[model samples]
Target: MGLRAVSFFAIAVVSILMFHLPYREVKTAATESLNQRQMLLAKQASFGIESFFKEQRNLLRHFAHSPAFLELSKVGKDVIQEEINDHREFVKAVTIYDKKGIIKYSYPNPEKVIGKDISSQAHVKKILREHKANVSDVFNAIQGFQAVALSEPMFEDGEFVGVVAFLIDFKHIAKTYIESIQVGDDGYAWVISRDGTELYCPVPGHTGANISETSAQFPSALAMAEEMQKGHSGTTTYQYNKIRSKITETITKHAAYYPVNVFDNLWSIAVATPESEIYSEYQSFYKKMIFATVVLFAVLIFFGYTIIKDFNLQKLNKELEKRVAFEMDKRQQQEKVMLQQARFYSMGETLNTIAHQWRQPLNIIGLCVQDIEDTYRHNEITEKYIAETVDKTMKSLELLSRTIDNFSTFYTPNEQLTELNLYSFTKQIVSLLQEQFESLNINLKFDEDGTLQIRKSVFFDAKVYPDVLKQIILSCLQNSREAVQKRLRSGEISKGEIRLGILRADAEFSIVIIDNGGGIKEEVLDKVFDQYFTTKSVSIGMGLGLYISRNILEEYMNGTLSIKNYKDGAMVTIKFKDSKES
Candidate 1:
C-alpha cells in the first residue's frame, strides 16, 4: 500500500505537469511574438532615421546640379544665399569647394571661408577621392555647431568643377528623428556611430559619450558596437541602469539595433524597452493557468483510482462465470453419453426379442414351403414354380437372420482397431435401415469418384473406432431422415435420396454420405460440432450427436469428419488415413 501510494503521487505530479505544458508553451510563444513585434517597430524607427539623413544628402546632390553651384563663377552670390536661406531650419551653412578641396564659394559670409582651405574635412576628402556624393558622421564643423556634412560633386560638361556641401545641424536631426519615436513605457530610441559613440541620445547629457564597456565589466556594449561595425542587425539584452525601474536599481533591457547606411556612411539606430513592461500582462493569467491544471490533475487521479478498483471486481466476476459454465458443460456431456449407451442397450434387447419371436416361425414357414414343393413334383411346371418359390423363401429367411445379427452388433464393443471391408461393412450398415427408408419411399445408393482396381472388393484399415463410425453414420442418416420428412410435409421434394460414396486416394479413404434434405444454415456450420449447439426442437435433440461423433472420429480414429452443402442437402465426409489394402 505504501508503494502504491508513492506511485500514485508520482503519477499525479506528472499529470499536473502535463496539464500545465500547453500554457507554458503559450507563454513562450507570446514572449517570442512580443520580441518580434518590438524588433519590427525598432526596424521601422531605424528606417525613418536613415530616411531623414538620406533626404538631406539627396537635397545636396540636387543642389550640386543647380547650374549655379556647377558654374559658380557665372552665377550671382544672391542665388547661393537664397538656397542657404531656404534650408536654414536644418542646414547650418552651405559651401562650394574646388577640386583641390579649397572653398571656392560660401553662403553666409563667403569672405571668411573663401581663402582658407577647408578641404581637410572627411566629407570633402571623400568627394575629392571618389568624385561622388558623400555624407559624414556627426562632428564639430565650420558652422560652430555639431553636424553631419552632406557633399555632392558638381560637374560642367562631364568635367569635375567642384563640390557642393551642406552642413546640417545634429540637434535638428535628433529632434526630428529620435525624440518623436517611442517604444514600451520605458522604451526610447537613440543613434550611435560605429565606434560606439552616442551621436544622438534621449538623455540630455549622454550624447558624445561611449557606453561600449559596461561598469559591471560585461562586454555587451562592446559586442553591440562590433555588430554595428559589421553592419549586422539583431536583438540583444544587456544590464542597463540608464532606464531605471521603480526600485532605481540596475535591470536588463532588450534592444534591437539596425545599421543606417545613407550616402555611403554608417550609423546605428537602436530601441530599448524594459523587461518588466514586456511581460506584465501575462503574470496574473499564469497563476490562474496553474490552478486549473492542479484541479484537472486531481480529478483525473480520483477517476483512475475508482476505475482500477471496479475493473478488478469485474475481472473476478468473469472468472467465477467461467468456472460455473465449465462445470455445466462437463455434466451435460456426461449425461449425453449415458443416455446414448442406455438407448443402445435398449435397442440390442429389442433386436434379441425380435429374433427369438420370428426365427422359429420363419423356419416353420420354410419347412411348409418344402412340403408344398414335394406335393407338386409330378407336374413339371408346378415343380419348377415350387422350386423357385422355396429358393426365394430360404433366401429371405437367411437375410432376416443376418440383419438381426447385424443389429445386435450395434452395442457390441469392437475397440481393437482392425481393417474394415469397405464394400461389405457399408452394405450391412445400410441394410439395417434399408427397409425403414424404403417404407418411407427413400432411395439410398453408393457412387465412386475414383477407380478401384478390384472395384467389387474395396477395403480400408480402421484408423478410426469402427463402432463410433457406425454411430456417426447412424446419427447422420437419422438426421437426413428427419430432414426429408420435414421437406415431404412441406412438399419440397417428391422423393428422398441418400447416397453413400466411397473414394480411394493416394493414402486415404473417403466415405461420403449425400442426402436430399434441408441443408444446414451457413451461420452455424462451424459450431454444429460444439457441445449443446443445435437448431432442432429440444424434445427431439440433445445436440450431442455430432459433437460426440466428431470426438470419436478425431480422437480414436486419427481421422477427420467434415460437412458441406451439396445440392439441396448436406454432404458429410469421413476420411481415414492409410487406405492400405488388407
Candidate 2:
C-alpha cells in the first residue's frame, strides 16, 4: 500500500509537470501568434487611415472640379447642401469659412457661431500657412462634439481664397472600429490624442474617460501619441497594470498606432488587445496534457499488476501488436484522405479556370457555324468561300493549340527559359476570342507598332498562366461585352465599341483594352480586386481571374496591371517588361 501510494504520487507529479510543460510552450506560441495578429491589424489600420486621407483628397478634388465650386466665388447655403448630399460619407458637415474665420455658410446650421471668427484656429491657420489641405487630429469642436477636420484652401484664380472645412466625426470613426472588432471580454481598444487626452474608448458608456486613469495607465498610448506628434507610426507591445489588474500579470498586451497624417499631432489611431486573451487556447491544451499524462501512468500500473497476477506475457505482446497496428492504419488512412481532399481542391480550381478559357472559343465556333449557314442560304458558299471559312476555322484551332501549349508548359513549375515572340503569342490569343467579341457587337482591335519579344519566360511574363491569361482576357472581354449587352438589353447602347491595343514604348510593352461599357461605379472600384468581389449575383468568373492574373504579372513577370475610367467607358492597361532590356 505504501509503494502504491508512492507510485500514485509520483504519477501525479509527472502528470502535473507534463501538463505544465506544454502550457509554457503553448503560451509562448500563443504570444507569438497574438503579436503577429496585432501587427497585421496595425498594418490594416495604417492602410485604413491612409485610405481615409485619400478619400478626403478625392472629395476635395471632386468639389474643386465641380462647376458649382469653380464658378461661385462665395459658397451659399444651397451649395453646401448640394455638396453634403453628394458626399455624405466624407462630409460630416461642409462649412465655408470667410477670411476672417467667420462661418459664412454651414449646411447643418451652426446658427450660434455663424459670425464667430475662428481664423486663429489651428486647422484654419495650418490650411492658410500650408496653402493646401490640412488634416487635424481628434479635438474638441468649437461646437458640441469631438471631431477631426480636413480643411482645404479654396483658391480664386491664383490667389488664396477662403477655406472649406470638412468636419470628420471622430465618434463615428471610433464606433466603426469598435463594432468591427471582436475583442475579448476583458480586452478593449482606444484612441488617444497627442495631448494625453483619450479621444475614444470602446467600452460601453466610457467615451470620455481619460486613458491615463484606466488600469492600463495608457503608457503605450502616451508613447505612440508622442511618435504620432513626430509623424512616425507603427505598432508596439508593453506590460502595464502588473500591480493593479488581476489578469494583466505576466501578460504583455500589444498596441498599434496609425499616425493621422504628415502633420505634427500627438494623436494616433491606437488598437490594444490583451496577450492572454489571444493565447487562451494554451490553457485548454495544458489541461488535456495533464489528463493524458495521468492516463499514461494508470496504464503502466495496470500492466504491472497484470504481469504479477499471471506470468503469461504472450497476451500482453499480442495486445501491444494489435494497438500498434491500429495506430499505423489510422495514420495511413488520415494521410490518404488529406491528400485526396487537397487534390480535389486543386483540381477544382484548375477546372474552373479552364472552363473560362473554353467559353470564348466555343462562342467563336458557334459564330462560324452561323456565318457558314448564312452564306449557304444566300448561295454565296462557293468553294472559295468554303476554303476561306475552313482556313479561318483552322487558324482558330491553331490558336487553341498554342494556348494549350503555353498552359501545359506552365504546369511543370520548373522549366528552362527560351526565346519567345510576345507579339505573335498575344495575337494568337486575341484571335481566338475575337469572334466572341464581334458577336457581342464589341469592336475588338489589336494595335502593335513594334515587335515585342520575351526571352526564356514563364506564363507570368505574359501576366498569367497561358491558360489563365486566356481566362482573364475572356473574363474581361465577357464583362465588357456584358456591359454592352445590358445597355442593348435596355435599348441604351446603339453604337458601342471595344478596342484592344498592344504597343511597345521604350523597353516597356503594354496591352490596353478600352470599351464603351459604362465604367464600374466609383464605390465598387476600390473593392474590384478583392477575392469573390462581384456586383452581379452569379458572376462568369470566380472573381479570382484578375486577382490571379495580377499575381502572375507583378509577382512572376515583374509587370503592372491598372485600370482607369476612359471616355464614356473603362480602360484596363497591362504593362510588362521587354525581357531583352533585362
Candidate 3:
C-alpha cells in the first residue's frame, strides 16, 4: 500500500510541474508580443501627429513671408481675403495683429474679431515679447470651435512688426489622425498636452479635461501620464473603469505612450487595449493545456510511462508548429495591408500632380476668351486680331490635349518605343517649363545656344518611350524648380538657376540637371530616392517624384538615374546605354 501511494504522489507532482511550466512560458511570450505591438502603434501615431504639426507650421511660415503680408498696408485686404479663400480647408481664419497685439486685419467676416485685443493671451504675449514664432495649445476660439493658433512673427527692415496667426481647426486634425487609430477591436489612442490636459480621447467627457484632476481613481493611469509628461517613451499596464453602453466595468489595460515635440511644445500619445482582449487566444490554450495534463496523468497510471511521454512530446511539437504557422499568416496579412496603403497614397499624389499640371493651361484658355471680349468692347475687333486670338486659343488647347495624352501613357505599360533626337527631346521639355520657372524668377537654361560646345558630329538618337521619358524629365525639372524657389525665398540667392545639358561617353549618354539650390543633406542624400521621403513640406511634395523617375528609367528604358551634390547644389544624371550598343 505504501509503494502504491508513493507512485501516485510522484505522478501528481510531475503533472503539476508540466502544466505550470508551459503556462508560464506562454504567458510571458504573449505579454512580450503585446508590449511590442503597442509600442509600435504608439511610435507610428506619434510620428504622424508630429508631421501634421510641422506641415502646419511650415505653411504658416510661408504665409507670414508673403510679399503682401510683409508689406501689409500697401497690399490692402484683398490679398488676405484671397489667401484665406485658397486655404480654407486647413485654416479656419487668418488674423493679423499690430505690434500692440490688437487685431488689425481678419479674413472671412473681419469685423467680428478685428480690433480685438489679444495682448493678454499667452501665445500672443510670447510672440510680442520674444519676437519668435509660437504654436498655441488647443483652446476655445471665438470662431465657436476648438482651435490652435500657429503664429509667426512678422518682421520688416530688421524690426518686429506684429504677428500673423493662422487658426487651425483642432477637431478636424484629431478626426483625421488621432481618431483613425485602432489597435484591436476595443483599443483606442489618446493625446495629452505637456500640462496634462487631454488634447484628444475616445472616452466621453475625457477630452479637454486635465488628466491630473480627472484620473484620481486610476493611479496607474496617472503614473503613465507623469512619465509621458517627462517626455519618456515606454509601455505600461493600467486599470480603469471603462464605461460602454451604460455599463461600467473595471478592466486592466496595456498601453504604450510616446511624446510628440512640436515647436518645443510637448504632447503625449498613448495607445491602449484591454488585457483580456490581448490574452483572448491564450485563454482557450490554457483550458486545453489543463485538459491535456489530466489525460496524460491518466495515461501514466493506466498505460505506463512510455506512452504518456511520447504523447506529451508529440502534442508539444504540434502546438509549436501551429503557433509558427499562425504567426506567419498574421505577418503576411499585415504586409498586404501596408502595400495597399502605399499604392493608394501614390495614386492620390499622381492625381494631385495632374490637377496642378492642368491649372496653368486652363487659366490661359480663360484669358484668351477674355481677351476677345475685351477687344470687342473697345471696338478694336478686326480680321487680323480675331485670327491672332484664335491661333493663340488653338495652341493652348492643343497643349492641354497633349498633356492628357502624356498622363494617360505615363501610367500605361509596354508603350511602343520611338527613335528621337536626345538633345531636341530635352530642349522641348525645358522650353515647356522655362516660362513657368521665369514667372518665379528662376532661370531654366538648356544647351540651346551651343554654349556647352556639343560636337555637331555626335549622334544623339535614342529609342525610348517618348511620353515616359518626358514625364521623367518634367518631374526632375519640377523638383529643381522647387529647390531653387526655396533658396530664392530664403534670400540665399539673388537669382535661381537650373541648367540642363547632355554629355556623351564611349559607352553611354547622359542628361544632367544641376541646380543652384542648396545641396541635399549628407544624412538624407542616400534616402532621396526612397519612397515617401521628402525634405519639402507635405503640401508641396509627396517624395514620389524621384522614386518614380528612377524606377521608370530602370524598368522601362533600360537606363539609370543618379543624384549627388554638385558645386552649389544637387545634380541629377539620367543615363542610357548607347543606341549603337542596343
Candidate lDDT scores, in order, read 0.68, 0.61, 0.76
Estimate the overall C-alpha local distance difference test score of candidate 2.
0.61
Query: Cα miss at 226, model 3 (Å)?
Result: 0.4
lDDT of candidate 3 over 269-307, digit per residue (tens): 898889888778667657765675575556445433333
TM-score of each: 0.47, 0.50, 0.53
Candidate 2, residues 401-501, lDDT tens digits: the string is 76677556544343323445455656665655555556556566666444333431342243223443444565676666667666667776776577776
Instruction: Compute the lDDT of residue 368 as modeled in candidate 2.
Output: 86
- For TM-score, the strongest prediction is 3
The list of candidate 1 runs beyond 4 A from truth reads: 15-20, 73-76, 142-144, 213-216, 242-248, 289-582
Clashes of 2: 3
Q: What is the lDDT of residue 106 in candidate 3?
A: 84
Best by lDDT: 3
Pull out the clashing pairs in model 1. Answer: 464-557
Listed per candidate, the RMSD to the true structure in angstroms reads: 40.0, 15.1, 25.0
Clashing pairs in 2: 194-266, 194-267, 418-456
